[model samples]
Target: MDKIATVKWLDNLCLVGQTSSGHAVVMDGPPDIGGQNLGPRPMEMVLLGLGGCTAVDVIMMLQKSNQAVVDCHIEVSAERAETIPKVYTKIHVHYVVKGRELSEAKVARAVNLSSEKYCSVSKMLEQSAEVTHDFEIVELS
Candidate 1:
């Protein structure tokens, strides 16, 4: 299915993005670029999307497997090119899974599946950036 979104200029270097699904997000540039830094940059939103997409996939997969998941966090980091149209060169994703007696093997498998097959954002970014992932499981007392 095709998704639709619109970004409207709010003010100097600030814009508001609205999705067809009825979600909204604010974006802005740095002060040097005439922005107030009121919100995240557009590139930062890309990383956020990547992290959110994969986190959802991993959490859902774990829950489907009957794992007692309590919390899931995803950290995404990236490097951009030095030239104009600076696109991401490399991206790294880290997953921290918290639960009771979670199987290490299952957690690893879920992370792998999300990065390799399930996450659409990951697949799209990997076209131009080298995307890699790792995970750590935190056992609950």
Candidate 2:
């Protein structure tokens, strides 16, 4: 199935995006580019999408494996090229999983599966950037 989205310019390098799922997000450029900095930059939104996608995958995988998950957070960092059309050159995804007696093996497998097979955003970004992933498990008392 194909998804559709719309981005409408608001003002002064600012825009609003509506997702196919009916969610709305505001985007803006930096002050140097005449942007008011109302919301996140467009490239930042890409990282946000990647983080959200992987977070969902990992959490669901853990739950299906009968792991008692308390929280799951993803941190995404990237580097852009120096030249024009400054596309991302490197990207790293970090997963912090909090749970009760979570199996290390299962957590590792979940993270691996998301980056290597499940996460579509990661797969797409791999075309232009070197995407890497790692995870740490936090046991709940």
Candidate 3:
């Protein structure tokens, strides 16, 4: 599938971009970079994308496994290279999963599968960054 987006410069260091799916996002650099802190930085969007990608996979895998998952949250952290062409060097995805009778093995397996096999974002980021994951299961009565 081919995806596309258009980024329109809104102001100094600020831009508004829209995806082929018609979803819009605002981006800007830090104040030091001439941005007024209008929205998320472009690099920060990458982290958000990664989180969204893996969260979807984990939820889908749990559903397919007949796991009763009520909620799922992911915290993504990363370290970026300090030099030019700055890129992510290391990344971590921490998942908080909630449900009833949520099997520990299933949760781990789902996260592993997403990180190792299913999540395209994870796979792509792993090419440049060391991606790691940890998950916690919260049971609800």
Tell me, by TM-score, which candidate is best: 1
Residue-by-residue lDDT tens digits, candidate 2, 1-141: 676899999899999999899999999999998999999999999999999999999999999999999999999999999999999999999999999999999999999999999999999999999999999999999
lDDT (Cα, tens digit) per residue for candidate 1, span 11-102: 99999999999999999999998999999999999999999999999999999999999999999999999998899999999999999999
TM value for model 2: 0.97
lDDT digits (tens) for residues 42-68 of candidate 3: 999999999999999999999999999
Sequence-dependent TM-score of model 3: 0.95
**What's model 1's overall lDDT?**
0.97
Off by over 4 Å in 2: 1-3
The runs of at least 3 residues in candidate 1 whose Cα sits more than 4 Å from the true structure, single-residue gaps closed, are 1-3
Q: For candidate 2, give the lDDT.
A: 0.96
- On a 0 to 100 scale, what is the lDDT of residue 23 in model 2? 90
Query: How high is each candidate's TM-score?
Result: 0.97, 0.97, 0.95
Error of 1 at 84 (Å): 1.1
Q: Which of 2 and 3 is the better model by TM-score?
A: 2
lDDT of 1 at 114: 95
